[model samples]
Target: MKRLTAAAGSNLPVGPYSQAVISGNLVFTAGQIPVIPGQHIQPETFEQQVRQTLRNLETVLQAAGSDFDHVVKVNGYLTDPAQLEPYNRVYAEMLGHAPPARTTVCVSLWGVALEIECIAEVIDHRLRV
Candidate 1:
């Protein structure tokens, strides 16, 4: 069987899935919503929720021993396509030049404001989750 490892674990997963899984040299993270762990924020603003979503993704990556710079690809799901501008600004600000190949589309959010998923390739061959 292939060994699978997780990055981070909050109180509980909103759905029946993992926050992230690591196999071989690749790490894949499940979509994250804007709702903060252990703290439910309702009527979350678009900008605020987007920032929080990235923050959550960052935490997962860190826990997996891989940072944003190691990310090779990202899939962004925005409830509204018009939000691309604002989300792009925020993502660029945080990600900087380490922009991974990303594809953003408008998808009805599962249960929250924003959702983000990513796959990263850690440069260091020494680390294998």
Candidate 2:
């Protein structure tokens, strides 16, 4: 198993935890919030926050040798049920047509509107012969 930090363009973890972990062919990412990388400031609008959070998730996935197409599962947390429609719109736009299995629920968050975490299969090109 290997632990990873946020990639170059992603925000550092706020607490004592790895941004992602690799085990064999799979990579699991920690929940990502909308705080700007290196700036620690979150975007004001919900859509902006969702996009930022997805960017952070993508950074971590790339660092783990994976991408959205390789993701197998996703867990999302939203502060309110009313945000679901907008969240789905942004999610569909970013994740493309064939998204992974997902579970999203209303929950309380610190200061952000939503958080996302995912599990993905790693693509180790070096192993190809």
Top TM-score prediction, candidate number: 2
lDDT of each: 0.74, 0.89
lDDT of 1 by residue, 1-129 (tens): 122234444424655677677778887888777767667763356777778888878878777667888999999998877899889988998886878899998878666656889998644555574
List TM-score per model, in order. Answer: 0.84, 0.93
Global fold similarity of model 1 (TM-score) = 0.84
The runs of at least 3 residues in candidate 2 whose Cα sits more than 4 Å from the true structure, single-residue gaps closed, are 125-129
lDDT of each residue in 1-129, candidate 2, tens digit only:
888865677887779999998888899999999988888898888999999999989999998888998999999999999999989999999986779999999999988899999999999764212
Candidate 1: the clashing residue pairs are none
